[model samples]
Target: SLRQDHEVVGVRAGLEEETLGGGGSSQFYDLNVYLNELLCIARLLDQPFQQHFRLLSSSLSSPALVLPGPPKSLARCRAKAQVDYRGMRYPSSAHLLDVVRTTWVVQDEESLLEALELLLASQIPLSSPPSSPLRSSSSPTPSSPSGHTVVRVKNGFRRRGGYRDVKINVVFSSPSGFRVIG
Candidate 1:
């Protein structure tokens, strides 16, 4: 089993709510939403990459995230889409993974703030009209005018007690079709 062997098939993203009762807030994203957003970003990064993935399994009830190196401990995580990122099977998939790894990191409060700032800087609300200069129908962000699907910022100023977590969705989409993994 993945948990027993501690096999890291994919990236481990920790999403925690700092506030004692902020997990349920609408401002923050639930696990489902977070994964879906990620899936969409993957699609946006490279259309070919999106078609290469398939829904393997979702350990939502017990999503295991094994930390590498000393003091290896599990973190709160979710994996909805699994891709064939091994070697030449899907060349661009590795790049997508690298982009995800580069953007998603949560070691401490400072790191979390930095990531949040990145998201805030990189993303604009999807609700923005097409005419909005900051966003167009096709472009994801100005920094990524070429091809870079990054975190999308949503409204809501969380309370001080809220958890320090990034919301993600669990979704999978292949050439066959799109399915909500969870």
Candidate 2:
């Protein structure tokens, strides 16, 4: 089985922030939401994901090269922000993966901070409102903006017990559609 050959290398956590952007919190949330999605994939192969993946080690190397020796090709990936017709924040998980690799890397305190930012970004959407709308609306837009879709911001805070906590706030959108002004 795929899991048998490759140990269920722990899920990749916040890397986007480490390499690119960051959230305004020291504590980061786990991508447990992605776990359900991954587990669902594992179950397809009749495998149980029990093993955990922690950071073995990391340093400022030239990064992994596609081919060995000089003239090596770097595996580069870009993180793009996606916005739905309605404006909503979709955390850039794909960007995080491009940064620190995975969450297991947060062994030390400093790395933890970086991890938190990346993880937070992953949880949220990567998008901003378009400068100009493709089409104009004759009717006045709703106050909420996103309409039925809701936008939530969960803040991650550091605690005394060397752990972090998250608080979530849900905001309903207005009737017309959500707007990403920023």
Candidate 3:
């Protein structure tokens, strides 16, 4: 039905134009006019198919956007006690510490680092008695007279990679709770 309708219109237009005696300069001009009309019809016929093909190809190449489910290991770990911090629940103290450390590194703010240091210095019990059987009970954890905790630092040098490849997480907390000035 569509094919017949198009053909009828084209034939009627051609007949009307021929009867109107529109002046044409040469054979080349007539040929060019014919080609232009043919091209217009071809484009009209092709548009729907082109759109359909584009949609089909895009769907085939990529998955539909959908919310992801919780990670399997995280789901299992969630069965244990969770710590609430910064409006989020973490599976454990270690997880919370890791997240805090990562946030500190990502933000790269001097104030945040200082705040973290203060929080760690105040919260963590640095002078607790040694739990090792070899060490005496009277010996307290190492600290400076100014109340700064003494930390042992060991540097591991790698030949191939730069600092960008390395990730560091530092956790500091006192027995009471974690605090930041600003």
Better-scoring candidate (lDDT), 2 or 3 = 3
What is the Cα-based lDDT of residue 85 in candidate 2? 13
Model 2 residue 88 lDDT score: 20
Q: Write the per-residue lDDT of candidate 1 for residues 1-182, one digit (tens) a residue.
A: 11100112222222333432444432233335433443444334333332221111121222223221111111212321223322222111222332222113345656545544543443322221112111234532232112112333332335456544454322222222211111
Candidate 3 to truth, TM: 0.19
Better of 1 and 2 by TM-score: 1
| lDDT for position 61 in model 3 | 25
Candidate 1 residue 71 C-alpha distance from true site, Å? 29
Best by TM-score: 1
The TM-scores of all predictions, comma-separated, are 0.23, 0.19, 0.19
Candidate 2 lowest-lDDT run of ten: 47-56
RMSD of each: 19.2, 20.8, 36.7
Candidate 2's displacement at residue 33, Å, is 21
Tell me model 2's lDDT, rounded to 2 decimals: 0.25
